[model samples]
Target: MVIADLFKKTEITVKNIELGEVETLNELTPEQLQLIEKGLQTVGFELLDDKRKQIVQKIKTIIIEIVQNQSKILQKINPSVYIAESIGRDYKYLTTLFSEVEGTTIEQFFIHQKIEKVKELLVYDEYTLSQIADMMYYSSVQHLSMQFKKITGLTPSHFKELKANKRISINQL
Candidate 1:
């Protein structure tokens, strides 16, 4: 009876694996390339060819590191300085590369990520709009609202209301 149960468990595990429910590192050689492909697919973005893709990947790493340290770093760091210092590449080169590969300026990409973070903060409802603006380093709540409306076509209040109704995934941004 125990042997039969063990066999059944093994069969079910095999079925799950066959159905793509199980993931393993062996399935993903060249891990960095796999990650880049997956990230683009997740966000409905397209990958450039290998060389351009690598450049974009580096830019993304810079963005991610900055954002992760946003609270500590943003207060003292201007965007240009942040880009230059963190990326170890001249700001002009990085911006030109980002624009060539992404079809958007680096500033535009940064704004998009900021807007996405604002959306997430608004959805949480933990912070007031003013507090969100302050935390995110906007000059004022009005400034935050203006940018939010410009990018999302909704005011912060309206966004929070809609968020109450239906949530949007930040990754999908």
Candidate 2:
């Protein structure tokens, strides 16, 4: 059987591959699959064993969906209940699994994601810091600035001045 077939039989789904370009897991060569698996291993987080890796991927998918749909809204709308129901597991179970595997809570992961989004907005230079803060659900501009500084080691204004490449590809994080 093909390497991709092995992955499929193991219920592993590759993420972010383009549509119409080898849609099924069964299309990859053994070497390609090995390389992909190695890359995941090198990511330096213990929560990436086969089962936890799937759970992490699922959480990432849900976060991305929520961000895309609610980009304009500031407050945290409790994650849609549909997400937990759709995942076929209790939210508490998934969250505990995530924290145990990732060494951080899911809320912290979400905050990191939001901070990354804030960096993207700062790079764009289209929105004021207040606007960015509001968009990302920060309670106030100061709150956003504090969290941004904590994460990035620079104030938002300093980041704006640098105008450096601020984008962190999701997988790289």
**Best-matching candidate per lDDT:** 1
Per-residue CA lDDT of model 2 for 17-47, tens digit only, reads: 4311224445666675565566445553222
TM-score of each: 0.65, 0.61
- What would the per-residue lDDT of candidate 1 be over residues 1-173, giving only the tens digit for each residue? 33223324433222222211233333334654455455556556554556656666767766756654555578888877877786587889878888888899887787778888888787778989888887788899999899999999999899889778676568866
State the weakest 10-residue window (summed lDDT) of model 1: 12-21
Error of 2 at 94 (Å): 1.2
Residue 18 of model 1 has an lDDT of 20
Q: Which residue pairs clash in candidate 1?
A: none
Give the Cα-based TM-score of candidate 1 against the true structure: 0.65
**How many pairs of residues collide in each model?**
0, 0
